[model samples]
Target: MGKEFSSVPMYTESAEVTKSFDDDGRIKRTGTLLTASSHIITAVIGSGVLSLAWAIAQLGWVVGPAVLMAFSFITYYTSTLLADSYRCPGPVQGTRNYTYMDVVRSHLGGVKVQLCRLAQYGNLVGVTIGYTITASISMEAIKKSNCYHKHGHDAHCSEPAYPFMIIFAAIQIVLCQIPNFHELSWLSIVAAIMSFAYSSIGFGLSVAKVAGGGNNVRTTLTGTTVGVDLSGSDKVWRTFQAIGNIAFAYAYSTVLIEIQDTLKSKPSENKVMKKASFIGVTTTTIFYMLCGCVGYAAFGNDAPGNFLTGFGFYEPFWLIDFANIGIAVHLIGAYQVFAQPIFAFVEKSCQKRWPESKFINAEYMPFMGSHGFNMFRLVWRTIYVVVTAVLAMIFPFFNDILGLIGAASFYPLTVYFPIEMHIAQQKIPKYSFNWMWLKILSWSCLVVSLVAAAGSIQGLAVDVKTYKPFK
Candidate 1:
C-alpha cells in the first residue's frame, strides 16, 4: 500500500480547484435521490433481512407479515421526521447538521446528544460485528454448499467461521480507506444490487419449494404453538426475540441524517430524503414480505435463520452458493456503509483535539487524483475492523446477536430521538394531540425494545452455555 509520493505538499488554492462547497462549507454533496435511496437500501437490506424467514417462522402467518408492514410504516414515518432534522429551524433554509449526532445536538442539546452519539456509534459497532459473523457464515456456506454438491447432502462438511471472518475483516480494512459516506456512492449501488440478488434468490427458492409439494409444509396462525413446540416461557422469549430480528431488519435511521447530509439542496434535502426513504423502505418492505412470507411458507415453523446458508436447500447447491456469495459481497459494502461514520467521528475528533499533531492532520497525497493517505485513518480503521472481527469470532451466534443489536438501538436511535427532535423543531404543543400521540408512540417502541432486548439476552445466555468460542 506504499505510495511513492514525496513530502506533504503546501496547501494552495487554485482557480481549477473547484472550491465549491455545500452550505456547511464542506465538499459539495452531489448525492441524488437515486444515490440516497441506494445508500438506504444498502444499509436497510442486509444480513438482517437474511434472518427474516426465521423471524417470520417465530411469528407465523398473520403476525409475521403484519409486523413487517408495521415496521416499514414506522421506519418511513420516522425517517421523514429525521429528514427535517437534517436542517435545523427550517427544512431548507436552516443550517445543515452533518451527522446524526449533530442533529441531536442541534435540536435536543445536552446529555441527549451524547446519548444519541453513544447509541448511534454503539449500534454501528454492533452491526459491524454482526455483519462480520454473517458474512463469514455466508463464505463458509459457499464451501459447505459446494461440498454438498460434490458429496452427499448428508455428508459432514462443516467449517469454522474464523478464516472467513479474518478474510472479511481484511476486506473491510481496505474499504475503510474510502474515507467518508459521501465517497461511497459506487459501493452503495453495488451493495444494493447484491442485496436484491440474494433476497430474490432466497424468495424464489422458497416459492419453488412451496410449488414442488415434496416437502411437508407446517404452519400456524399465531406462530409457534405453545406446549406443542416449546414451553410457554420459551415461546415468549423467542417471540420477542423474533420481533427484535424484524426491528433490526428495519434499522437504517442511525445513519439517516448522515445520508441526508449528502444530498444537494435543490428541491430541499429534507424533501429528497423523504422521497428516498419512501422508496427505500417500500422496496425493502416488498422484499421482506416476499422472502419472509414465502420462506415461512416453504419451511413453516422450521424455517432456518438463513434459507440459503442454513442448508434449507441442498439441491441446486450452485444457486445456494451464489446467493451466499452475494451476501458476502453485499456485506463487504454494508460494513463500510456503517463503519465510515465511526471512522469519520474518531478521526475528526482526534484532529479537532490535536490540531497541531502531524500524524493526525497531515495527509500524504499520491500523484493520482485528490485522495489523501493518512496514517491515523489507516491504522485506526484497521484496528477497528480487527476488533470487530475478533468479537465476531468469539461470539458467532447470529440471530441472537442481531436481535440484541436491534433491540438495543431501535428505540433511541430510530424512534425516540427523531420524535423528540420533531416535537422540538415543530414546537408541537405540550398537551396537543400530536405531542400526545408522538409520546405514546415513542413509549410503545421503548417497551418493545426493552422486551426484545431481554429476549435476546436470554437466548445469547443459552447459546453461550453450550457453544465453545472460536468454533
Candidate 2:
C-alpha cells in the first residue's frame, strides 16, 4: 500500500526550471506552506463536515472513525501523486501541468482531458450547490433558534431557505471576483478559522449533552448507548452513503495542482503540497472525529443530515447563532476557492474559441488590468452563479447533493486517476506487485463510488418528487 509513495520522485528538476510570467514582467506565483495549507483546509472542510453525524449513524462509532481516517489517508496519498504528476516532458526540457485538466491532457491525451474537465466541473458545481444549501440552512437555523428563545414553544420561524440561498449566491458573486488563486489566501485563512470555530462549538455542545444525561436525545436506542446495529440492505446502502460523505469531505484533489502552481518555488512545490495536504487533512480529521462521535452520541440514530440544524431549539442560543454565522461565512469563501478554477477554464476556453472577440484583451477597460475582470467574467460568471443558486433553491437536500458529487466524481478524481497516472508516469509494469495492488485499490474504490452515486441519485429522485421548491 505504501509502495506508491516510494515509486514517484519528490521533485522533478524540470518543474523547478519552468517559469510563468504576467504581462507586467513581475513574478506571478505566491504561496507559503501556511497559505497553501489554509486553502487546502478551506477546500476540504466545507459544509460537508456538518453531516458527519449522519455518516456516523450509517457506520456507527466503532467503524465510523476508522473509515473516515482511512479515506483521509487515501485522499492524502492520491493528492501527493497528483502533485508529482505535474511534471511532464517539455519541448526543451519538461513542462509543468498547472490545472487538473492539464495533467490529464499531458498523460491521457485530449479525449480524456475533456472527460476530466466534465468531472471536475460537475464536482465543483455540485459542491457550490451544497454550500448554498448548507449556508441557507444555517441561516434558517439561526432564525429558528432565535425565535424559539424569544417566544418559547409557540414560536414559528417562517423564513425559508430560498431567500438565504439567493443571499449566499450574491455573496459568492462578489468573492468570486477575486482573480488570482494566491490572492484568495487570506480569505481561505479566515474560512479555515471559521471551520475550526464552528466544529469546536459543535463538539463542545455534543460532549456537554452526552455528559449531562443524554435524556434530550430524540431517538430510541438498543439501551441508551450511542451506536446503532445496522443490518440488511438498509445498512448496505447507508454504508455506501457514508463512504460518499467521507469521500466528499476529503475530495480536494482536483485543485491540488492548481494550488501548487501558485507556490514561489516551483522545484519544491511538490514537497510543499505534500506537507500542506498532510497538515490540512490531519487537522480536518481530528475535527471530524470530535464532531461526528459526539454528535451521534448526542442525537443517536435520529441524527439529521445537517447537524447544525438538527440541534433544534437547544439552550445557549447565542452559540448556535455564532456557529451558524461561522458556517455562512465559511461557505462564502469556500465557494470562491472552488469556483475559481471553473471560471478560469471557461474564460480560457471562450478566448480560444473566439480569438477576435473584444473580450479577449483586458487592455482597454478602465478597471481591467491583465488579471482584472473581462467580458466573460462579467457575463458568464454571473450566469453561472445565478444558475447554481437556482439549483440550490430547487433541490435543497445538502447530504444528498454531497453524496451524488462524491459518488460521481471522487473515485475518478481522488483515487483512480491519480493512481493510474502514477503507474503510467513511473512506467510500472502490470505484473509488479505495486501496480497490481494499486489497480485493485482503484477498482474497489470505483465500485464503491458507483454504488454511492447510484444510491444518491435514487434518493435525490425521490426528494425531487416529495420535496417542495421553497419550503
Candidate 3:
C-alpha cells in the first residue's frame, strides 16, 4: 500500500475563520437581489399615482413624461441615498432603528430635535389627513356613482355622499384602532394585488383604445375651465407642484431602518434591503409612466379627479365600479399603514395618564372595573376621524389638500432627516461637507415642497368657492 501520511492540522492562533454554507454547501445568507423592476412598481403605486394622469395631462404629452421622469429620478436617487445612509431596517417596524427626533438631536443638537419633532408631528398629521381625505373621496365617488345610477341624475345624491363619508371614516378608524399593526400586512398585500390588476388592465385598455384609432376630442381650452390650459403660470406652478408630489412619494425613509433591523441576517441585510428598494422604486416608476401616458391619452381635457377622469367615458359601468372598489381598498390599506404609528403613539400617551383604565386591552372595553370604553382611545380615534372627515367634506377635490400636506412634510422627513441621522452616526464627517450634490438636492426639495404647499393651499381655497349645499 502507498504510504499514507496523516494530514497535519494547520493551526494559527491569530487567524480566524468563519464558515457559512447553504444546503448545498454554497455561501449561506448571500444577499438576495431584488429586481429593479419590482421596486419601481411598489414605490410609484401609492395614492399619488392615481392622480398623476390628470397632472400630466395638464402639462400636455410633450412636457408630461419629461417632468415626471425628472421627478422620478429625484425621488429614486434621494430614496437610495437616504436608505444607504441610515441603513434603516424597513417599514415593518414602528420606529426606524433611529427616530427622526433622535437623529436631529444627535446631528444638530437638542434645539433641532425639537424642530424635527414639530416637523415630524406635522408630517404624520398631514399624512393622516391626506389618507383620510383620499379615502373619503373614494367613498364619495362610490356613493355619488351609485346614487346617480339609481336616480338618473346628480340631484338627490349629495346627502348620501356625506353620510357615506362618515361611515367610511368610522370603518377606517375602527380598523386602525386595532393594536397589532402587523396584521394589516394582509391588507397591504391585497391592495398591492388590486393595484397591479387595475393598473395593468387600465394600461392594456388604454393602449388598445389608442390603437383602435379612437376619436380623441381635445376639450375647449379656456382659463375658465379648471386645469385645461397647460401654458402660462399654470405650467410653472405644475412644475413646482410636481416636487411636492415627488417628495411625498419618497417621504417614508424613516420606515426603512425598521425594515433593515427586522432582517434575519444582519451582515447581509443592507444588501437585501437595498435590493428591495431598487425593486420597489423601479417598478413604481414604470407603472406611473404607463398611468400618466395612458390616462392623458384617454382623457385629454375632462380628466376626472386624476386618472379616473380618463376612464369616466369608458362604458361597462361595472368595470368602473370595480376600479373604484380597488381604489377604496387601496386607500384603506394606505391609511392603516400610516395610521398605526399615530395610534400607538396616542395609546402610549393615554396609558401613561390613566394607568387604571382597562380599555388598554383588546376586549374593546375598559379594564374589569372600568365603567366605559377606554375614553382616551375612543376620544382620540373619534377626533381623528371627525377632523379628517370634516376636512375631506370641506375640500372634496382629490389632489388639492393631499398635495399640500405631502409637500409640506416631504422635505423634512425624507431628505433632512436622513442627512441629519447619517451625520449624527458619524457615517459622514460633520465638518468635511463634501457631498455638494446631496446638499443641493436637499435644498431643492425644500424649496419645491414649500412652493407646492402654498399652491395646494391656494388651490384648496379656490375649490372651496365651488362648494354647494347638499341637494
Candidate 4:
C-alpha cells in the first residue's frame, strides 16, 4: 500500500527488466495465481457480506439472489476490463499506468482523472467508515455478556458501537501506516480465511435456528412486514436501498488495480487477474447465497442489520465471539488494503507540490522501509483514521452507510469508468454495434447506480431525523 510501482524507473537496459510481463525490476512480482486469487477474495469479501441477508431480505428470495449474481457478473466483467485497460497502446511497458487514477489520466484525460480521483477517494474513505462500523459492532458483540440471547429475545444491551469504534480506530492508526497492498499479503490471506470462517459459522447458526423449531422465519419485501404493498413510496424506496446494499457488498472494483499489481507479469497479468476475479466472485457468491438464504430462513424479517448479529444462541456463545473476532480482524486488514491507494496518491501529490520540502527524501523508501516513521506518514494516516472513526461514531448505521457508499461510487468506479476506459483504449468505433451496446450497458449502469445512490441519501436523511448517536 505504501510503494508506487509507477515511479520505479523502467530498466530498458535489461530486456528481462522490461519484460512485458515483469515489473520494471522495482517490484519483484512474487505473487502466484493462487495468491492473486486470495487477494481478490480478500478484497471482495468483507464484513459487508454479513449484511447481504438484510439486503436480499428487501428484494425477497427471487430478486435478492438475482441482483447479487448480477453484480458479481457486472464486477467481474468491469474488473477485467480495468486489468486489460492498464497497459498503453504501444509495446512499451514503461508507458503503463499502475493506478486507477493513472488509468483515467492516460485514457480519458485530466477531467475524468480528477473525477476518478474523487470517486476513488470517496470509495476508499467510505470503505474505511464501513469497516470501522463493522469492527466496532463485532467487538461490541463480544464484550456484551449474554448479549447473544438478548439480541435474539429483543432485550437491551449496554455495549455500544462508539467505544469499540474508537478502539478499532486506534488499531487502524497503527496498521494504516503500512504503505502498500503487497505488504499486507499475509494479512489479506488471514482476512480471506476469517471471511470464510464467519460465513460458514453464520450459515451454520441459521441452519441450527431453523432446525430447532424456531418459528421466527418471516420473510418480507419491506424487511419488516411480509407482502407489503409495492405501491407505497416507503416500500419502493426501501427496495432500492436494498439494491445499494447488495451492490456495496459486491464492490471490489475500486481495488482491482492494486490487487492486479501484486501478481507477476508471467502467464499474462490480465489472465491471472481474470482467473482471480472468477475464483473470488464465485467463492463469495456461494458463501453469500448460503449465508443470505440460511440467515433469512432463520430470522426472516427479523434478521439484524448485520446477519451475524442476528444469532444470539447461548448453546455455543464462543462461536459468536470467534465469528465477531474474525470480523474485527478481517476488517483491520481490509482498512489497510483499501486505504493504501489514497495514501499513495496523497503522498505523491505532497512530493510534487513541495519538492523542496524537508520531508521530501530523494532516496527511495523500499517496502517496510525505516523511513516509515516519518512525520508526514504518521500525521496524515492518523488524521485519516481519526476522521473515519468520527464519522463512524456519528453515523453507525451499518446497512445504510453501505448503501450510501455503494450508491455514490458503484456506477462511476465499478461500472462506468472501466467500460468507458476500455472503449476509449480500444478505440471502439462510435457508431459500431459493439460501441452502441457498450454505450447502452454503461448508461444503464449509470442510471441504476444513480437511483441506488438516491435511495441511500433518502435513507440517511431519515436516519438523521431519528438516529440516536452512540445508541
Candidate 5:
C-alpha cells in the first residue's frame, strides 16, 4: 500500500548507495519490509483469488472460511521456514541462496534439488498459464459487461475467449522485456494496488447484492445440496477442487527466498521476510474473507467462479468494467513476477551451454543503458508467452486450471520442501516433537494435494466432454 507516492525513495537510484554490491557482488540489497510485503501480496493474491467464492460455495459457510484460515497459517509458517533457508549456516550470517532451488541444494542436496526445480519452475509456468486464462476471462467479461450495459443481463452476450488471450499475450510480450526479477518492485507495487482495487470492488458489489435484497440466494452450513445441486460424486470432487482453490489463493512461498534476497543485509533477511510474509498473508486473508464470504452470500450455491467477471452484478456495469480492467492490468505484471525466475534459469542455462555462441551470450540494443538486449532471451521469452497463451486458449476452464495449479504447487513448494529443509538445516533430533509434528504436517498436506489434484483432473475430464479446444 505504501507505494512511495510523489517522493521516490532516495536509495532507489544507485548513485546514492555507499556500496554497489552485497556479499554476493550483485546489486546492493535495497528492498525494505514494505517492498518485500508488496511483492508478497502481488504474488499471493493473484488470479486465483477470483475463484474463492466458487471455492467457498463448494465448502459451504462453515468450512470455507475455516479452510482459508488454515491455509493462511500454513502458508505463513512455511514461508518463515523458507525465509530462514535463504542463508545457509544460520539465518543472519550464512552465504546467501539466490533461488529456491539453491536453498534446496544448500540444505538438502542431491535429488531434492531436482525436485525443487520441478516444483518451483513448474508452478511458476503453471501460474503464467493461469494468469493468461484469468486475464482473458476478465477481458471477455469487460466486453460482456459493455454488452449487458447496452442490452440487458439476459441478452445473448457470449464472447470467445481466444482473442482476449491473444491480446493479453501481446502485452506480456512487451513487458517481458524488463529482463529479470530485480527491477520488479515497482511493478509489484502497481500490481498490488490493482489487486486491492478489484478485490474491494468485488466485495462492495457483493455486499450491495446481499443488502439490496430479495431471497435470491441459497446457502447451507456444509455446501451445495448433493441431490439437488449435484450428484454425490460431484459433491466430493467439487469440495476437493474447492480446497485446491483455497490452496492456490495462499500460494507465494515458492518465491519467498527470491523476494528475501532483495532485502538489505543489516537487518537479517529472514527476520524482515517473516514480517513481510505475515503482513502480506494477513492482508490478503482479510480481503479473501470479505470477498469470498460476501460473494458466496450474494449468489449462494450459484456463485460464479469469478466474482467480478461472472456477470453476478450487471447493473453496476461501469464498475464491473473497471474491476475487470484492473484484473487484466494486474495479471500483466504478475505474469512476469512468476515468469522471471523461469526466464533467468533458462537464459543462464542456455548461456552456459553455448558460451561461444553469440546469439546466446552477446548483448544488443544498448539504448536501455547498462542492460542491453540479448537475442536468445528475447526469442525464448516471447515463445514462452506465446505457448502459455496458446495453452490458455486450448483449455479455458478457469476453476479446473486454478485447482490443478494449486494442488500441484501448494504441497511441494509451500509445505514439503520448506519443512524438509528446515529439519535438515536445524538438524532437529530425529523424533523430537517439532520434527514429528512437521513430518505430520507435510504428510497431511501431501494427501490434501493428491485429492485436490484428483478433483481437478475429474473436473477437467468432465469439462472436456462438452468443451471443444480452440473453438
Candidate 6:
C-alpha cells in the first residue's frame, strides 16, 4: 500500500508570530492592549508637570494658559499629521529605528540626514543633562529635608554628593532599560495619580490662603507703566520671544514614533497616541489654569519664591518636602524614558567602533547584565549622576537650570522634530499640504526653534559666567 499523507499547513517566515520582550527582556505573549487613557496619562505626567506652573508664571495668569493651550494644539496637530504621514519603523526597535534623521535621509538626502542626526544628538544630550539636573536637585531637596530630619545636621547633606545621586540614577536607568512598555505603563498611572493629587491639594491650599486675606498684590497689565516696558520694536521682539518660549515649553510630542511602535495593534496604537496627547495637554491646561488662578491670586507679581512653590500658604519646609519627594519620583520616571535612546545610541556607537567585537552577541557582556542589577549599568548611571550633581552644585538655582534645559533640550525635541518630520513626509507625492496652515506652522516652528536654541545658549553661557565654586 502507498503511504498516506495527511494535509497540514506549514509555518513560514512570512507568517505572523506572537512573542514579545519587555525592557528587561522577559518573554511574553503579544497582542496585549493598552488603552488610550493609560497612554495619555503616562505621556502627560512627567518632570514637566511640576515645572509647567512655574514656566507659566513668567507670563502672568492671562497669557500663560492661552500660550500653553495654543502651543498644545499646534504640537498635537503637527504630531498627528507626522504620524499619519510617516511610515514608522517596526515595533521591537526603539525611536532610533526611524528617527527624524531617517525620515529626512529617505526624503531629503544624506546631508540633511546628517544635519538632523546632529540636531537630534544635541537635543538628546541636552535633555539627558537637563533630566539629570532635575533629578539630582529633586533628590538633594528630598534628602536635605527628610534625611537630615531623620538623621541630623551633622549628617552629610551636600549638592556635590554624587554617590547618592548615582544610586537614584541607577534605579531610573534600570526602569528605563526594561525592554517592554507593559511594565513601564504602570509608571504613568502612578505619576498621574500623584500629580493630580498634588495639583488639587496645592490648588486648594493656594485658594484658601488667598481667601483668608494673605498678601495679594496685583500687578498692572500695561506694558509701559511696569518695568517690562515693551514699547515699539522691543515689545514686538519680546512677544516673539515669548511665543517661542511657549512653543518650547509645550512641544513634547517627539516620543510619538516610539509610542506608536510600542503598541501591538495599529488602530489601538493610533487611538492611544491621540488620546494620550489630548489627556496630557488637557490635564496640563487645567493644572495651569488652577495654579495660575490661585497662585497669582495669592502671591501676585511679588510672589516670594518660584511662583508654583510661593503660591501656597504652607510653610517652606512643608512645601519643599512634598515637592521634593513628588518631583523626585516624577523625574526618575522621566529619566527612564529618556535613557532608552541614550543607552541604545551608546550601544550602536560601540558596535560601530568595534565591528569584530561581537558586542551584539547575547552571550557577550550584556549592555545591562543578565540580572537587572549589574556593574555595567552601575558605572554608566554613576557617570550620569555625577555629571548632573556637579552641575546642580555649580548652578545652585533650579529655575535657571530648568529654563536652560527646557530651551536646549525640550524645545528641539518638541518643536523641531515634528516640523522636520512633517517636511520630510511632504516629499511623498500623494501627501498634500494645507498651504496656509503649513506655511504658518512651518514659520512658527522655525522661529520658535531658533529663539529657543538661542535662548538656551544664552542661559547656559550666563550659568558658566556666573559659576562660583560651591561653598
Candidate with top TM-score is: 1
Could you tell which candidate, 1 or 6, scores higher by lDDT?
1
Q: What lDDT score belongs to each candidate, Candidate 1 first?
A: 0.89, 0.78, 0.57, 0.78, 0.88, 0.51
Model 6: per-residue lDDT, tens digit, 353-399? 75444223122234444423333334555566456556545555444
- TM-score preference between candidates 1 and 6, better one: 1
Per-prediction TM-score, please?
0.96, 0.89, 0.75, 0.90, 0.95, 0.74
Report the Cα RMSD per candidate.
Answer: 2.5, 7.7, 11.5, 4.0, 5.3, 8.2
The 10-residue segment of model 2 with minimum total lDDT is 1-10
> Over the full model, what C-alpha lDDT does candidate 5 score relative to the true structure?
0.88
Give the alpha carbon lDDT tens digit for every residue of 1-471 in model 4.
354322333244454654343555454667777877777777778876888777777777777778888888888888888888766663135255678887788888968888998898889999889989988988887766366454654556666678899889998898877766767788888988988998898889889888998475678543544354344676677777888887888878888887777777667678788888889989998988998877777777656778776444444778888988988988888888888988888887887898666454333445664533455777888998999999899988788889888888889998889989888878899989989988888888888788888878888888889877766
lDDT of 5 by residue, 1-471 (tens): 111112112134344434776766566878999899999989888887899999999999999999999999999999989998999989888888889998999999998899889999999988999999999999999899999889877899999999999999999988897866878999999999999999999999889889999947899999899998999999999999999998889888777888887899978888999999999999999999999999899999988888788888897788999999988888888888888889988887887688778777766655545556667777998999999998888888899999999999999999999999899989999999999999999999999999999999999999999998876
**Tens-digit per-residue lDDT, 1-471, candidate 2:** 111111122245344423554222335567889888999999988887998988887777667878788888888888888878876642113466769888888877857777888889888888888888888999888888888888884656666888888888887777776665767888999999999999888888888878889455644322123344444655666677777887788878878888887775644677888899999999999899888878888877767788887753277999989999999999888888888899888877776787667655342323433344455577778889999999888888887788888888888899877887888788889879999889888988888798888777776876788787765
Q: Clashing pairs in model 2?
A: 90-94
Instruction: Put down candidate 3 lDDT per residue, 269-329, tens digits, no spaces.
Output: 4556667676666667788789766765666555554564223534444565676677667
Tell me the spans in candidate 3 whose CA falls farther than 4 Å from its real position: 1-44, 84-99, 102-109, 143-160, 217-231, 249-251, 254-269, 309-311, 352-379, 426-433, 468-471
Q: Best candidate, lDDT-wise? A: 1
Kindly provide the TM-score of model 5 when superposed on the true structure, using C-alpha atoms: 0.95
Question: TM-score-based ranking, best first?
Answer: 1, 5, 4, 2, 3, 6
Which window of 10 residues has the lowest lDDT sum in candidate 6?
Answer: 1-10
Q: Please say which candidate is ahead in lDDT: 1 or 4.
A: 1
Question: How many steric clashes between backbone atoms does each model show?
Answer: 0, 1, 32, 7, 0, 8
Higher-ranked by TM-score: 5 or 6: 5
Q: Candidate 6, TM-score vs. the true structure?
A: 0.74
In model 1, how many backbone clashes occur?
Answer: 0
